[model samples]
Target: MATSKSVLFVCLGNICRSPIAEAVFRKQATDKGVANDWRIDSAATSTYEIGNPPDHRGLACMKRHAVPMRHVARQVTQDDFQSYDYMLCMDESNLSDLNKKASKVKNCKAKVELLGSYDPQKVLIIRDPYYGSDQDFETVYEQCVRCCNAFLEANS
Candidate 1:
């Protein structure tokens, strides 16, 4: 393992799942008193929401859980393959995208995975709340929170 640990959360767009996962993990690390030991951020596979804030529903979901996240949307960069210890995608589609990119990098491919892999009981996508109702955001928040907590427990 690297001396310093950093994670990059990813999704199709940075507006929903990825940002929420970043916030959830940040909050989880803080709650575990390991915030100083790990770093977390998020990115999009596409540039649709580049430079934009997280989706409004996603923001509300984070606020509801007291997860503080202030992020400007950005597309995943090749440089991130070298920078982060882990690149966690919200689902299989995004994971496939990362895998293809990771394949081009020699050692970096070892560090990418699906966030659902961290789930203890069941695997699931960190569903997109963009086109859905507020409840969708809440559900995504719950899944992200669960995965984030599990990640901290296993890693720390």
Candidate 2:
């Protein structure tokens, strides 16, 4: 029996990079027929966009790539640190915030790390696209695809 793997993609606001990574990873997993072997989700290190859907630009970017993305922004809770096997974040600030939160959870199980760390291209940051042009969103989507693919490949 194969044990299901679980991961939570996280960022500062949850409206941009994290959601894209989550969607991209999920789509790739489903395409490979292994989505059932994983529990996937996304969240935020901060409360900035809680309860809100992903940014419009991100939605548009996903549409352009034919990737499905549906997520409500949510802040990371101490419980998340226990629920997920891995909690991958967009950048250093999110990584720092998640690590700080994990420190408070006495039984934290999630491994907090940068989602960019999995990028084979060596891109270390998945920038926030809330203020940038649609091109910026495209760049984020491209990076997410690369990083998500590498992460999935490494685990498979």
Candidate 3:
């Protein structure tokens, strides 16, 4: 049997890109019959929108793509750096923030990197759609799908 892996998806806020990526990754793993082999979740670098559900546009985008997503917004914790096998963030800012936070935690095991780093299409940053239109939300979803699939492939 394969050993389980864990990942924490992170963004500026948990309401948009990260949640969509978390959902897309989870569903992809499930469809590939490997959901039980992973621990997947999402969080924000800051406390903004703590306890809030994903943005409405994100929710709708996931629904339209038939991907299920339900998560309360949360800030990344020091313990997260010690637990998750990977800390995948949406952009350069989040990468910097998480790296700074991880540096403060002894024995931080998570490999912090941009989620878009896994994108086969070469998109290196997953932009926030909070101020954009539905098309922006759809774009996030599409990017997550591509990146998540590639991540699963690489890890599997």
Clashes of each: 0, 0, 0
Task: Give the Cα lDDT of each candidate.
Answer: 0.85, 0.91, 0.94
Off by over 4 Å in 3: 1-3
Ranked by TM-score, top first: 3, 2, 1
- TM-score per model over all chains: 0.93, 0.96, 0.97
Candidate 3 per-residue lDDT, tens place, 30-143, comes to: 999999999999999999799999999999999998999999999999899999999999999999999889889999999999989999999999889999999999999999
Compare candidates 2 and 3 on TM-score and give the better one. Answer: 3
Top candidate on TM-score is 3
The deviation in Å at residue 79 for candidate 3 is: 0.5
Which parts of model 2 are misplaced by more than 4 Å?
Answer: 1-3
Candidate that beats the other on lDDT, 1 or 3, i.e. the better one: 3
- Candidate 1 to native Cα RMSD, angstroms: 2.1
On lDDT, the candidate that comes out on top is 3
Which scores greater on TM-score, model 1 or model 2? 2
Candidate 2 residue lDDT tens string, 1-156: 554799999988899999999999999999998998999999988887899999998999899989999999998888888878999998888888888788889889998889899999999998888889999999999999999999999989
lDDT of 3 at 18: 94
Model 1 C-alpha lDDT per residue in residues 30-49, reported as the tens digit of each score: 88778888878899999899
lDDT ranking of the models: 3, 2, 1
